[model samples]
Target: MTEIELNNEYFEWMCQLVCNERYSRRLSYQKLLRHLHNIDFQYMLPMDGNRAEDGIDLRYRFGYEKEYEGSTIASYLDNSPCSVLEMLIALAFRCEEHIMTDPDIGNRMGQWFWNMIVSLGLGSMSDSRFDAAYTDDVISRFMNRKYKRNGEGGLFTVERCKYDMRTVEIWWQMNWYLDSIL
Candidate 1:
């Protein structure tokens, strides 16, 4: 496959791994996939690369099957632009898929995916409403630890948070979120 084709395949795979219809009321699966593709396209890692590594590690830690249509993270990152946001979003999907036990939510993982997007205030940035400036600003804030102590703009926002969600890792923040809703 050509470079563009390969990138498109990889993006579609990642979107499939993360997209869920039940939780996508604000944004459809197709729009979410396109948005993720855009986000990944614009993503540039920091000098240290710790954050990128962390997000990649999280995706792997979730044990997601990455051999999609003959593409892996190595191949995808080898060609396309690098970004943690999409990977982290995928990680959240996997985490909720495996960890959360909320039966009422039906598709728990899908709900968690949208919840995180909504938590970051990205739900309204649909295809028609997508503004790169707003998307970039929110993504930068998220990666740079600019979210509030209680995780106002982060993936998991806890009401009356006991721990500083920005300082806390995503795993623990997810746990906090599960606890909060339970």
Candidate 2:
């Protein structure tokens, strides 16, 4: 496929994630967050070296949340592929350049990432370690810290942020699967 076409596909996929809250709202909270954190999103670039929606509500309801409420951290980590979050990271890695160049796109990814963390649980909000994740000034700068709803308040300001792309290299290596897909 041509570069533009590939980029378009990538863009639309993300728009769905941002626009269609139904899927995101129903994500497996703990599983999604864990998966999101593990995939390095800082240096991954698209094969070709390749937008925002509305709210950032970090709420969830899904397979694990129901049957796995009492699941321990170990179990949650080993939770069978939640699919969505990891898929997102893979996409980010595939289209890193396209995503990084667009502040809106990067911010949305950051929004999605932060929302996933909040969706995990309110306890994560108060944890200092959450803030520690972006201690790297570059990673911290590309994210959005003012994404609260009209009056939702930034109770978890540190954790509720999203990436704005900026000029930083916030992506890691692309997923191996992208080799054939691209």
Candidate 3:
């Protein structure tokens, strides 16, 4: 998988935060994990009018219960390219079996990924659309965010992605609610 250049501190901190709250009920985190749980509820399929708050069973782990270790939001982000947009789209694509013809891939894993993408603001789940170029564009923006063009306009000053203090601080604030539970 191609990695997205990221402010590693922001991305890793988000990863670690998700990891820590894999069992907790952080709102945004849960918003991102709604579809990875049990099928007993059987709320509508992801592509069919699935909402962010839909499929969210707060008490349950996003994937299998603690009894069996399985996929979770933590694992999804870990496998991603570090761009939120790319990560959501990429993971959704990865879980899909029919990449070109369908978006849901007609399976539980696919549904979960699709729903999570919708919840996390990736795109419309109802639309059966996929774009490789858009994914590339998103990655480019993320890569460009870490560098500044030189006066020559031909070169860039490579500041690196991981050390972005602003992103790290934003993540810190976004996840501040977790501190109370931790």
* lDDT, candidate 1, 1-182, per-residue tens: 46566556655666655564545454554654565545652222343244345445543433245444334545544443445455565555556666865578554555677677788878787677777677778877876778888887977899999888877666677788888988
TM-score of each: 0.71, 0.21, 0.23
Tens-digit lDDT track of model 2 for 1-182: 44344323433443444333543443333332443334333222232122110111111122133242333322333333223333443343324444334665444444434433342232232323334344223222323323332112211222222332222222222222123233
> Candidate 3 on 1-182: residue-level lDDT in tens?
11233223334433332333332223243223222211122212333112222222211232333332333344432342223322333333333432323445433333434344332233332223434444344334332333222101101111232333223322231122123223
RMSD of 3: 19.0
Kindly report the root-mean-square deviation of model 1 from the true structure over all alpha carbons. Answer: 4.7
After best superposition, candidate 1 residue 85: deviation in angstroms? 4.1
Global Cα lDDT for candidate 2: 0.31
TM-score rank, highest first?
1, 3, 2
Off by over 4 Å in 3: 1-66, 69-126, 143-182
Full candidate order by lDDT, most accurate first:
1, 2, 3
- How far is 30's C-alpha from truth in model 3 (Å)? 18
